[model samples]
Target: MHCRPCEPRHPDAQRGVALVVALLVFGLSAALLVAMQSEFTLFYQRGSNLFLAEQGHAYLRGAEELATLALVMDHDADQSREQPRDDLGEFWAQQATPYPLDEGGWLVGSLQDLQGRFNLNLLAATVTGTGEDGTDSARFTPAQAFFIRLLQALPELQLDSREAIALTQAIGDWLDPDTITRPFGAEDDFYSGQSPPYRAANRPMASASELRAVANVTPELYRALAPLVTVWPQTPAPLNIHTAALPLLRSINGDGELVPLSEMEAEALFQRQRSEGGFASLDALLEAPAFADKNMEGVRSLLGESSSWFLLTAEVEVADRNMRLYSVLHRDERTVRAVARASGSL
Candidate 1:
């Protein structure tokens, strides 16, 4: 009754089991190899992106240095002249030709006078001496008045006198330290009810873009005003008449009436400033026929021929990676230096 205890398995059966094991092992190894390759590819891409970003930033820094050098050279050239002023005719004001780098890529940079635009920080400055009713009230500073006029003068904004005043006061509230709101302005009390619930800055704005956070500021309005105003020189910097846009130029006037310069009149002054390398003095500017009857006191104080704050926009492209750098440059009698910088946009 002894069974065939020693019956060996068939060769085909053994081969079939061996083939199944081999297939399983091969499939697992192939899957593992694919995963490893995917991970390696991801890391390689990350490293390549990081390298390109670093390289692009380095080129941007070089471009900033070039801008600084150009500014210094401009200062030197101006020093030799009897009246030193920054104007569009200067070399630094011209659009820079993109510099072809030794490696693939190019660099472009240009300097802009921030003083050519109205300083929004000036809205915070107020005179509290007296009001028409002899009661204590915050009165608009000369600079604020100038800003109102500038807003009204901008035909593209299509803002009326009252709307301009309200916007100006709203900006002032955003900057003033106290929570007391202006008659037409908003404070933390107003902003706290917003969807996200944010408070006012209650200090100088870091960038003109901050206007977007203020009340009643639309994207279209901000876009229109951003180019015509600045937030730097938070301590009431004069507007550089030579580089000021036509809208700002037209906004100059006395306090009695908001009589902005006409387009033809502003264009005349603009052309004259460009051809004459800027007005020799404030008195010379006042001599314009448009200003003959208008009181020039307030506008005169707000206007200047020189600028201390300038913006440098530098763009660099390397390895298909593009970088745009914005630097705030401060120029002194001694040298020019970068005060603040941002990547992508101002």
Candidate 2:
């Protein structure tokens, strides 16, 4: 039988195959376009977030400069007065409340008098402990005594007189130059015994948080003490009546006998200082009946109407970004300068 020639393919069938291939190509192109658009959108959002964050940081820096300007102006204004005493009525102190920024974010800053808190670093100045009669031990300075009295005032912390004394001794040991340990205080040995061992500072504490390194300074006690005491100011200073908390004010005595003032008496002092502005002079402060006793004599020079050092904190929020800036300012009779600055995101 002769093979018949193959029949020619129909035109309709060829057209159908071409249509199928065209549909596949179109579908693939559409999918690729959608993916590219999604990637572009994601990249744009990331860049926008980065821009806003940088803008927030810039705003924070501006806020810091404004704070410095305000402080310098405050000093200039104080120069005109017979006695320059910073008080709640002053512009810097009054600015503690948050204010809306002309920009999209808000700004808030406050001045914290460094000298208002007991200086923990002063323990380095003293050198005798009850346990070490022969060896050189640290004698409590007025600042340490103030801390002890402050501790006694916090009955809620349940720290008795003995514990308070021990805490003081421990702090002294941590700060003292010698490695000799007191009866209650911890030296390098005590710290080395912990889970993560460290050594005694054997020097001035860099931060108030270092108090946790001292013996008998539990988290509870530390929490109670953090706001009232400080390792800054280097030298000892007296409590600033304008800015002192009740616990610190109650520890105003030099003799360290559970602060002499009753609740009403303390409250009265707070009321006058808060309402009538702080005392212009130590003599004016001494006029109060609560200060009838002269136990506070040694600390008079520290009790001042004006502060030399201050901490300013500024927080700014822009869109989804939050920024916080911390500035430590040193203010003198003439000008204000930033001693330290730190910033971070929230």
Candidate 3:
């Protein structure tokens, strides 16, 4: 069949439709490509973070193992003592050393003597149980009293006598097994009624930070108390003769009043000792009158002549990443025990 030719369409109009379609296709392709690229970037970042976290964890474990090996190899190497001079424990004994990571990063580890802290387990004990009833009447010894007093001195805290007494009782209750009441103790009844309703640890705290879980312990109080105390697997471990902070020595000498020296004075003394290769003997501390007057026998009983526990705080900086870890280690004859581990990163 014969047909007339169709009229030609407007050239500009036809070109305009084609151009609009092409533009739409191109816009959709660009949007998809952008979306895909964004998703890939997010995945890569997340994976990198996870890898870094894992690397930090591995380095922390490596530190712990190295400490353990030191304990195992040396008979006299105690966690409470300064990090021993052996190869394994030496890494932590020194300041943090950065280790390079696989992807332009680094990791670092550090070790610190836990003996520098007061043993919280000994808080309620006395020089002797030999008063009137063959039982210690006071909840805390003079040494412990001094320690608590130092804790009270922190400007951030405002604990009255009653609150202080309550805290002492709470800590004692948290450690002791039986529900029996000491004069100011808080038992299971006290904690079971709290917001979370938890049971007592009934054992010594694994970490100083555990104080937050005890009854009536406020975060402020915990913050105030944390720097001064530690929880080791055992009691009466030798206090770190070398690393004990000046505040602790002040507490030891203060006779519950913390009167012997100002904080600055105490720090200065400690710095002097550290500069002079640490204290040769605890007797040097007696040069201060407050410590001199103390019952020497009682002080000796409460504080040890050597160290047996350590807290190792380490930080690793790799490229743009930084990580921190806290580890509690206990040393026995030829063995190191890890009590706890915690980590964070930035």
* lDDT, candidates in the order shown: 0.83, 0.73, 0.65
Clashes per model (N, Cα, C within 3 A): 0, 3, 7
Q: Write the per-residue lDDT of candidate 2 for residues 75-186, one digit (tens) a residue.
A: 8888788866777778877756676767666877777777667778765655334424332212455666666677887757856667787887888888889998865777
lDDT, candidate 2, at 128: 37
List model 1 lDDT by residue over 1-346, tens digit each. 8776788999999999999999999999999999999999999999998888888888889888888888888888988988788888888899789888888888899889999989888888767766565522226667877877788787777787788888988999999999999879999999999999999999999889899999999898888898899888767678888888888877876554444667898889888877887777767887889887766676678888888899998998787667899999998875888889999722
TM-score of each prediction: 0.93, 0.80, 0.68
lDDT of 3 by residue, 1-346 (tens): 9999999999999999999999999999999999999999999999998886787677767767866665464545344556442222233456666767666766566666667777788654534344444433234576566555556555567555566666777787788776765567678887788877987887777677778888778887777667767777565465665666666665555333423355666776677556765655566655554455545555555554445566777676655677788888776666677777778876
lDDT of 2: 0.73
Identify the leading candidate in terms of TM-score. Answer: 1
RMSD of each: 2.6, 4.1, 6.1
Flag the better candidate by lDDT, 2 or 3. Answer: 2
TM-score of 3: 0.68
Give the local distance difference test score of model 1.
Answer: 0.83
Q: Give the range where candidate 2 is weakest over 10 consecutive residues by summed lDDT.
A: 129-138
Ranking by TM-score: 1, 2, 3
- The candidate with the higher TM-score, 1 or 2, is 1
